[model samples]
Target chain A: MPEQTDRTENPEHTLVEVRGFRMAYGATTVIDRLDFEVVRGETFGLLGSNGSGKTTTLRALLGLIVPTAGELTIGGEPYRPGRVRVGYLPEERGLYKREPVLEVMTYFGRLKGMTAGDADRWSRSWLERMGLADKARLALGKLSGGQQQKVQLGVTIMDDPELLILDEPTKGFDPVNQRLLMDIIAEQQRRGTTLVLVSHDMAQVERLADRVLLLKDGVARAYGSVADVRGEFGGKSLNEVFLEVYGTVGLEEDAA
Target chain B: MSAFGIVLRFEVARALRKKAFWIGALALPVIIGVIGLVQFLGAQSAQQAAEEQAKAGFEFVYLDASGVVDARLATELGGAPAADADSAIAQVRSGETEAFFDFPADPSTQPVTIAGRHVGVIDDGRYGAVATTLLAESAKTEIGSPELVAIVAGGVRTDVTTYLPDGSVSTAAQSLPVGILLLALLFLTVVLLGQQVLIVTTEEKENRVAEILLTTTRPNAVIAAKLVALAIAGVVQMLVVFVPVAIGWALFGGGLSIAGLDLSQVVFDPQQILLGVLILLGAAALFIVTLAAVGASAPSAKEAGGFSALSIILPLAPLYAAAIIVTQPSLPIVRVLTYFPFTAGTTSLLRNAFGTLPLVEGLLVAAILFVSAALVLRIAVRAFRRGALEYDRMLGWRDLLGRPAR
Candidate 1:
């Protein structure tokens, strides 16, 4: 089935296409006329400040939330809830506190359509890779938060998802775990997975992203390769460029 | 190996690791045993104490207005003869005598009457037997038939025997404890299992786990796995409590006695048991699905609690209607509850246990519950997927009617 579908399509090219997308909650618009494309095997970054709708646009691409008005497609097909080949790591960190690590990972793998034995085998290898082989029998809550995050990441990639959407993947991790996460992301890209990384960290975004879209006030302020966007800001850092595009005065100014 | 099996395994493992699950599962049965032991010991001691108190000779008086010539009457009334009627009456009036027997002159007109201030204060089984004999004799005299007199007199000498054709008397005793235990076991299981659905949904909403899960898997699969998992955990807990108690009763001679109980008439046959179990599964499924859906609809766990409480409390209505259901299982209220997904599980189980359900009706009830469970599950999954992915958004009736989520 994979070969037949692959032969019939341009698998070496664009994997996700979002054209003239607009999303709104009532009168408050989050993404307006957004246009972008994610080529196969690239680690793309959706760079934005808080409430800049980075999460919103990524969600749209995965068909998690429908765009108020837009066209989004995945794998040369219209995005549907079950048909879309995407794995997502949401902004909030979540794990069933009582579930053993191996069991939790395998359960997620099976849900993504793998057989139980396959899921189990993949989970075992993933755990070994993350240095969690010995802790496979331990409940998720018994592990350290960083260890749990590794398990969550394993659940996402275990299915060999065609597209991966990770929101703030390194939000609560220390530098070491962050490095581990980056490695996993790099590995996924090498395996031809299209990644949409939503992050506020400028250094990580700059270092890893093939292309960057700076979203501000529900509009794309900058959309191009990371180098091109950075060059447009006259050698400014991604963080400085983000602040310039989306005014950072409201929250802190109100507090002061 | 199958999708369902994998989902089931994950759920069971997750629930088993929760500390609250173990505590709730084992506590009630132990408490029940301890309470039963205490009550039994207390009853035995009370009986022994009463026997000791009976050693003191009990005073008696006779109000024989008929002036009968038989001297054996007074002796039969008490172990020792009374000194005089006047003195005996004084003792009776002052409450010294345990009882006073009054035989009117025209015994043919009035039956014998026994008056006592503290008749039931002690176990006076002996005195009760004597009174009954005297009343029968008086009744015989009123009949005035020589042949019947011989039969009545013969009946007095005969030992009375009681038999239960349905063997329900013994079955009732056994069923009482088993039924209570089953009810409690199921109740606790529902609460524990149902809480998992609520907690998982709430945590997902709070921590945004649903968003991640929704991306790769269908919402229906997630919701289905959750309900199945909780149900399996519930069944396991029930078995843990049920198997031990059932085994102990059977092997230890304290098991449910079917000796005198006519179990043939019991309504809950094997088919009914199956139907009831199916209904229970459906009810449980519906309850959890509704709760998860509502929880998903809510903005936070605290808000979810309010909605989940509605699902939790709805099943209890059937319990309150238990007495009525047993008497009239086909009553409109019972019929409706039996058909409704939420109440059908428990009510139908009880009805089957009591042997009240008819065959055709039971199937209909099961079908209704099953279909309802499926429908609710579908809606719940949709709600969960929509709620998780849509950030800070509320689902309304309009949204459900609108275009399906892509």
Candidate 2:
């Protein structure tokens, strides 16, 4: 396993640290001896294609999946749930479909240790900020796909989590809301919230990420700042760099 | 508040807000209340109809001429002796008395003469039954000694006691309905409570809510809170369904006595009641947790719905074997059903209620089920934890069997 380097420029310091992390299900190792760090107040992009163990890594980092062998710390301590103010939006977007939009948001907010009144107040403010205040009382199922995505994002960010992990948060949004959501996430990042953004959208990652780690087949394909990765792939954009990285693997596997 | 409390309160409030929950929770009690109302109304209507019929029909006027028989016979028949037979006949003619039972001239073996207006109201069969009752009294007074009358009128009172092969005796005076009640209460718990566990857990899977919840709270906490919530819901629904029925039963069925039988005489073994309660709790734990696991494994609520029916049916199948259980208590099939964790509650309850299961055997079965229930709950927690992020897919059989899925 490679060692993780610590950068000295950050004030909030390291929020997530993984050293020699290994994860497996029975015989299949989904993540194999990977190392990474998510510094405080920075957007860390975990970039990978489908089935590349991105979700598995985030799950391990959050303590949802136990590491087969390694040390992982969140907020400078062993990863104990509810010990830190953390929020997550899973890739498969879902809320209580029978619940109204605001209710669903507040329920999750309360689960993250917010009191009902505080949760309710924050949830409604978020709904208003996201241009969904009128639909607060409507059932989540009644909302359009894009609207539900917005509500899901609201749930993820409403509690002002110190660290927030969003998996495919912009999945069903339109171009306008997509940019709107990106701006909102950037604003949250400016407020000193450490964010781990896991997605296949290279353009979004390149625009938002301060540092990035690219994984292929659960092994790091590239690990550096965006400019370093762009320079490694001959000054191409992160999207072109991603294509260059995986495009060779497809051919090699085909030839084999 | 603690995360468990938050989760529990959230789950319960969400479930109660649904229209289906309210409908399902209220259906049984409403049905029972309607039935109780009908029963009470039917009884009152029948009594009133009988009184109206009696007002229009023939009522006997005793016309005794034998001085020795005059007072006692009339008192026994709920009437008084007439001053004059001629006056009674006159009264009958004027509709004051519908009929007359004229006494014999002497208190010999001769039959009394009955006179009445020839109408449909003067049916001989009705008057004859009255006459036979009165004559039997007269004969007893004339010939029967006090002890003979006691022996003839009130025969031997026997209380049944069954001596088992083990030489321990059982009292058979308790109503069999108590066991049936235990059976009902057990199923109602499963239906009202266990099924909600299924729906709630399945909704978590179907909606992908577990994906977020697992990160915020521990899996075991999620499972624990879910079970607690469903338990509260089950108790609430059971009370809603049963409280009214119980009130109605107490109000109307207090007089629901069998002839020559006393409710106070019925006694049951405390060990057997405890066994029934143990069986109920064990079955509840097993069924609710197992159903939650099944629901968690299902990919969608629609799929879970089918398994939900199976959940209900599996616990219910033993109830259909009741006829076999009654006469062939502890028959192999019944015994198997009684000892198995899922089927044990209602089966052992029925058996215990019937005094069919011996105390030792019942205790052993309850202990096994209680242990099994505890184990299943632990297994369910493991399942919920492992299956948390498996959205849009099922727990593969290989994975469920503790083998590598890939």
lDDT of 2 by residue, B1-406 (tens): 8888888888788877888778988987787779989988999986675444433444667765664453565565555566688887788789887678877757467677776666555344456556555666776786659778877777657756777678977564364555556678888887677656767777777787787878777777788888888887777777878777677667866555545555445455566667777777777777887788777777765666776777678788876887887678747898788777777777777777877777788788878877987777766676676676676676655545563211
Give the TM-scores of the predictions, in the order they appear.
0.72, 0.75
CA lDDT for candidate 2: 0.76
**lDDT by residue for model 1 (B1-406), tens:** 5445655576677678778877777875777779988988988887665545433345556666765424464555463335666676677678787676666667668776665555454555545445545555546556779788988667545333333576533333224333444445457656666667777666667755676666655566666777777777777777777788667655755334454443333332355456556655666667777887877776676767777787888877798989998889878998888877788777876776665766777788778877887777767777777777544756676565566777
Indicate the worst ten consecutive residues by lDDT in candidate 2 chain A.
A2-11
Docking class of 1: acceptable
- Chain B, per-candidate TM-score: 0.64, 0.64
- Location of the lowest summed lDDT over 10 successive residues in candidate 2 chain B: B397-406
| CA lDDT, every model vs. true structure | 0.71, 0.76
By summed lDDT, which 10 consecutive residues of candidate 1 chain A come out lowest? Answer: A1-10
In model 2, what is the error at residue B261, expressed in angstroms?
Answer: 9.1
Model 1 stretches with alpha carbons more than 4 Å out: A1-12, A79-87, A109-133, A158-162, A183-193, A248-256, B1-3, B16-25, B56-193, B196-208, B244-285, B295-305, B319-362, B389-403
Clashing pairs in 2: none
Best by lDDT: 2
